[model samples]
Target: MRADVGRVAEALVEALPQPYGRWSIAVFDDPTPNAFALPGGKIGVHAGMLAVVRTPDQLAAVIAHEIGHVLADHSNERLTQELAVQGGLMLVDLFADEPGIRRLAVVASSRDIDV
Candidate 1:
Protein backbone atom coordinates (compact mmCIF):
# COMPACT_ATOMS: atom_id res chain seq x y z
CA MET A 1 0.00 0.00 0.00
CA ARG A 2 2.77 2.37 0.98
CA ALA A 3 4.70 1.44 -2.15
CA ASP A 4 1.72 2.30 -4.38
CA VAL A 5 1.44 5.69 -2.68
CA GLY A 6 5.14 6.34 -3.21
CA ARG A 7 4.87 5.48 -6.91
CA VAL A 8 1.88 7.72 -7.46
CA ALA A 9 3.60 10.55 -5.63
CA GLU A 10 6.71 10.14 -7.73
CA ALA A 11 4.76 10.13 -10.98
CA LEU A 12 2.78 13.19 -9.94
CA VAL A 13 5.95 15.06 -9.03
CA GLU A 14 7.59 14.14 -12.33
CA ALA A 15 4.61 15.47 -14.27
CA LEU A 16 4.77 18.93 -12.70
CA PRO A 17 6.30 21.63 -14.96
CA GLN A 18 8.77 22.65 -12.24
CA PRO A 19 9.83 21.59 -8.80
CA TYR A 20 7.43 22.54 -6.02
CA GLY A 21 9.07 23.12 -2.66
CA ARG A 22 8.92 20.30 -0.09
CA TRP A 23 6.51 18.25 -2.19
CA SER A 24 4.80 15.40 -0.37
CA ILE A 25 1.77 13.17 -0.90
CA ALA A 26 -0.30 10.90 1.26
CA VAL A 27 -2.97 8.33 0.43
CA PHE A 28 -5.75 8.10 2.92
CA ASP A 29 -7.48 4.83 3.76
CA ASP A 30 -10.81 6.63 3.80
CA PRO A 31 -13.29 5.79 1.07
CA THR A 32 -14.23 9.36 0.21
CA PRO A 33 -13.52 10.14 -3.42
CA ASN A 34 -11.63 13.33 -2.78
CA ALA A 35 -8.21 14.95 -2.96
CA PHE A 36 -6.76 18.22 -1.74
CA ALA A 37 -3.54 20.18 -1.81
CA LEU A 38 -2.17 22.52 0.81
CA PRO A 39 0.46 25.21 0.72
CA GLY A 40 4.10 24.08 0.29
CA GLY A 41 3.05 21.13 -1.90
CA LYS A 42 1.44 18.80 0.63
CA ILE A 43 -1.32 16.71 -0.91
CA GLY A 44 -3.81 14.08 0.17
CA VAL A 45 -5.53 11.62 -2.16
CA HIS A 46 -8.10 9.26 -0.83
CA ALA A 47 -8.06 5.63 -1.86
CA GLY A 48 -11.58 6.01 -3.14
CA MET A 49 -10.34 8.63 -5.58
CA LEU A 50 -7.66 6.27 -6.83
CA ALA A 51 -10.42 3.84 -7.73
CA VAL A 52 -12.23 6.59 -9.60
CA VAL A 53 -9.13 7.53 -11.60
CA ARG A 54 -8.70 4.53 -13.86
CA THR A 55 -5.40 5.61 -15.40
CA PRO A 56 -2.14 7.20 -14.34
CA ASP A 57 -2.69 10.06 -16.78
CA GLN A 58 -6.08 10.80 -15.27
CA LEU A 59 -4.60 10.83 -11.79
CA ALA A 60 -1.95 13.20 -12.97
CA ALA A 61 -4.61 15.60 -14.23
CA VAL A 62 -6.38 15.58 -10.90
CA ILE A 63 -3.20 16.15 -8.95
CA ALA A 64 -2.08 18.85 -11.31
CA HIS A 65 -5.28 20.84 -10.80
CA GLU A 66 -4.94 20.55 -7.02
CA ILE A 67 -1.31 21.61 -7.19
CA GLY A 68 -2.25 24.54 -9.35
CA HIS A 69 -4.56 25.75 -6.59
CA VAL A 70 -1.67 25.60 -4.12
CA LEU A 71 0.80 27.25 -6.49
CA ALA A 72 -1.64 30.12 -7.07
CA ASP A 73 -1.73 30.84 -3.29
CA HIS A 74 -5.53 30.50 -3.18
CA SER A 75 -5.46 29.02 0.31
CA ASN A 76 -3.49 31.92 1.76
CA GLU A 77 -5.70 34.44 0.01
CA ARG A 78 -8.78 32.77 1.45
CA LEU A 79 -7.31 32.85 4.94
CA THR A 80 -6.42 36.51 4.70
CA GLN A 81 -9.91 37.36 3.50
CA GLU A 82 -11.47 35.45 6.36
CA LEU A 83 -9.34 37.26 8.92
CA ALA A 84 -10.23 40.65 7.49
CA VAL A 85 -13.93 39.89 7.56
CA GLN A 86 -13.71 38.66 11.14
CA GLY A 87 -11.80 41.75 12.20
CA GLY A 88 -14.37 44.01 10.57
CA LEU A 89 -17.16 42.19 12.39
CA MET A 90 -15.35 42.58 15.69
CA LEU A 91 -14.98 46.31 15.11
CA VAL A 92 -18.64 46.65 14.18
CA ASP A 93 -19.62 44.74 17.29
CA LEU A 94 -17.41 46.83 19.57
CA PHE A 95 -18.16 50.29 18.24
CA ALA A 96 -21.61 50.16 16.72
CA ASP A 97 -24.71 48.99 18.55
CA GLU A 98 -26.98 49.33 15.49
CA PRO A 99 -29.19 46.40 14.49
CA GLY A 100 -28.46 46.99 10.76
CA ILE A 101 -24.71 46.75 11.37
CA ARG A 102 -25.22 43.49 13.21
CA ARG A 103 -27.26 42.10 10.30
CA LEU A 104 -24.76 43.30 7.74
CA ALA A 105 -21.91 41.84 9.72
CA VAL A 106 -23.75 38.53 10.02
CA VAL A 107 -24.24 38.38 6.25
CA ALA A 108 -20.62 39.24 5.59
CA SER A 109 -19.44 36.68 8.13
CA SER A 110 -21.54 33.95 6.50
CA ARG A 111 -20.15 34.65 3.03
CA ASP A 112 -16.57 35.13 4.26
CA ILE A 113 -16.26 31.46 5.23
CA ASP A 114 -16.79 30.52 1.59
CA VAL A 115 -13.40 32.06 0.75
Candidate 2:
Protein backbone atom coordinates (compact mmCIF):
# COMPACT_ATOMS: atom_id res chain seq x y z
CA MET A 1 0.00 0.00 0.00
CA ARG A 2 1.18 3.48 -0.84
CA ALA A 3 0.63 6.71 1.10
CA ASP A 4 -0.86 8.50 -1.89
CA VAL A 5 -3.36 5.68 -2.51
CA GLY A 6 -4.57 5.88 1.07
CA ARG A 7 -4.63 9.67 1.15
CA VAL A 8 -6.67 10.07 -2.04
CA ALA A 9 -9.00 7.19 -1.21
CA GLU A 10 -9.74 8.54 2.26
CA ALA A 11 -10.37 12.01 0.89
CA LEU A 12 -12.81 10.71 -1.69
CA VAL A 13 -14.73 8.56 0.79
CA GLU A 14 -15.35 11.55 3.04
CA ALA A 15 -17.48 13.09 0.28
CA LEU A 16 -19.41 9.89 -0.48
CA PRO A 17 -23.14 9.96 0.26
CA GLN A 18 -23.35 6.97 2.61
CA PRO A 19 -21.11 5.39 5.22
CA TYR A 20 -18.39 3.21 3.75
CA GLY A 21 -16.50 0.41 5.50
CA ARG A 22 -12.86 0.40 6.47
CA TRP A 23 -10.87 0.42 3.27
CA SER A 24 -8.23 -2.17 2.45
CA ILE A 25 -5.63 -1.49 -0.16
CA ALA A 26 -3.18 -4.12 -1.26
CA VAL A 27 -0.88 -4.85 -4.14
CA PHE A 28 -0.45 -8.03 -6.16
CA ASP A 29 2.88 -8.72 -7.78
CA ASP A 30 1.74 -9.21 -11.36
CA PRO A 31 2.98 -8.12 -14.74
CA THR A 32 -0.37 -6.71 -15.83
CA PRO A 33 -1.22 -3.06 -15.29
CA ASN A 34 -4.60 -2.85 -13.61
CA ALA A 35 -6.44 -1.97 -10.43
CA PHE A 36 -9.95 -2.38 -9.07
CA ALA A 37 -12.12 -1.24 -6.18
CA LEU A 38 -14.58 -3.85 -4.98
CA PRO A 39 -18.02 -3.30 -3.41
CA GLY A 40 -16.71 -3.89 0.11
CA GLY A 41 -14.01 -1.18 -0.11
CA LYS A 42 -11.23 -3.62 -0.94
CA ILE A 43 -8.89 -2.19 -3.52
CA GLY A 44 -6.08 -4.03 -5.31
CA VAL A 45 -3.29 -2.91 -7.53
CA HIS A 46 -0.98 -4.82 -9.83
CA ALA A 47 2.65 -4.00 -9.16
CA GLY A 48 3.20 -3.52 -12.86
CA MET A 49 0.85 -0.55 -12.81
CA LEU A 50 3.55 1.57 -11.18
CA ALA A 51 5.69 1.15 -14.26
CA VAL A 52 2.88 2.29 -16.51
CA VAL A 53 1.09 4.95 -14.43
CA ARG A 54 4.37 6.75 -13.48
CA THR A 55 3.12 9.45 -11.05
CA PRO A 56 1.05 9.51 -7.89
CA ASP A 57 -1.52 11.69 -9.62
CA GLN A 58 -1.92 9.10 -12.36
CA LEU A 59 -2.39 6.33 -9.83
CA ALA A 60 -4.91 8.43 -7.92
CA ALA A 61 -6.82 8.97 -11.15
CA VAL A 62 -7.11 5.23 -11.72
CA ILE A 63 -8.31 4.62 -8.17
CA ALA A 64 -10.80 7.47 -8.35
CA HIS A 65 -12.30 6.12 -11.59
CA GLU A 66 -12.74 2.63 -10.11
CA ILE A 67 -14.22 4.12 -6.92
CA GLY A 68 -16.72 5.99 -9.07
CA HIS A 69 -17.93 2.65 -10.43
CA VAL A 70 -18.47 1.27 -6.91
CA LEU A 71 -20.15 4.46 -5.67
CA ALA A 72 -22.61 4.50 -8.59
CA ASP A 73 -23.43 0.77 -8.42
CA HIS A 74 -22.76 0.35 -12.09
CA SER A 75 -22.46 -3.42 -11.72
CA ASN A 76 -25.98 -3.77 -10.34
CA GLU A 77 -27.33 -1.46 -13.00
CA ARG A 78 -25.91 -3.76 -15.68
CA LEU A 79 -27.25 -6.89 -13.99
CA THR A 80 -30.70 -5.35 -13.68
CA GLN A 81 -30.68 -4.46 -17.34
CA GLU A 82 -29.79 -8.04 -18.27
CA LEU A 83 -32.47 -9.48 -16.02
CA ALA A 84 -35.09 -7.17 -17.47
CA VAL A 85 -34.18 -8.25 -20.97
CA GLN A 86 -34.26 -11.91 -20.02
CA GLY A 87 -37.60 -11.51 -18.26
CA GLY A 88 -39.08 -9.74 -21.24
CA LEU A 89 -37.91 -12.56 -23.48
CA MET A 90 -39.35 -15.16 -21.13
CA LEU A 91 -42.69 -13.41 -21.16
CA VAL A 92 -42.66 -13.40 -24.92
CA ASP A 93 -41.67 -17.04 -25.00
CA LEU A 94 -44.68 -17.94 -22.90
CA PHE A 95 -47.40 -15.57 -24.18
CA ALA A 96 -46.62 -14.32 -27.64
CA ASP A 97 -49.44 -15.05 -30.13
CA GLU A 98 -47.12 -15.41 -33.12
CA PRO A 99 -44.86 -18.43 -33.38
CA GLY A 100 -42.32 -16.41 -35.43
CA ILE A 101 -42.04 -13.77 -32.75
CA ARG A 102 -41.58 -16.42 -30.06
CA ARG A 103 -38.85 -18.14 -32.01
CA LEU A 104 -37.09 -14.80 -32.57
CA ALA A 105 -37.18 -14.07 -28.87
CA VAL A 106 -35.76 -17.48 -28.03
CA VAL A 107 -32.98 -17.18 -30.56
CA ALA A 108 -32.09 -13.64 -29.52
CA SER A 109 -31.83 -14.54 -25.85
CA SER A 110 -29.77 -17.67 -26.52
CA ARG A 111 -27.10 -15.92 -28.55
CA ASP A 112 -23.71 -15.06 -27.06
CA ILE A 113 -24.33 -11.51 -25.93
CA ASP A 114 -20.98 -9.74 -25.85
CA VAL A 115 -21.53 -6.58 -23.90
| CA lDDT, every model vs. true structure | 0.76, 0.71
* Regions more than 4 Å wrong, model 2: 1-3, 14-19, 81-115
Residue by residue across 1-115, what tens digits does model 2's lDDT show? Answer: 3556677667777777888667667777887888866766777878877668867778878777777766666566657766876788688767877778866765675433322
Worst 10 residues of 2 by lDDT: 106-115
What lDDT does candidate 2 reach at residue 99?
72
Worst 10 residues of 1 by lDDT: 106-115
Mind sharing the TM-score for model 2? 0.58
lDDT of 2: 0.71
Candidate 1 on 21-102: residue-level lDDT in tens?
7788888998988888788888888898888887776777777777776888867876887687788878988898887987
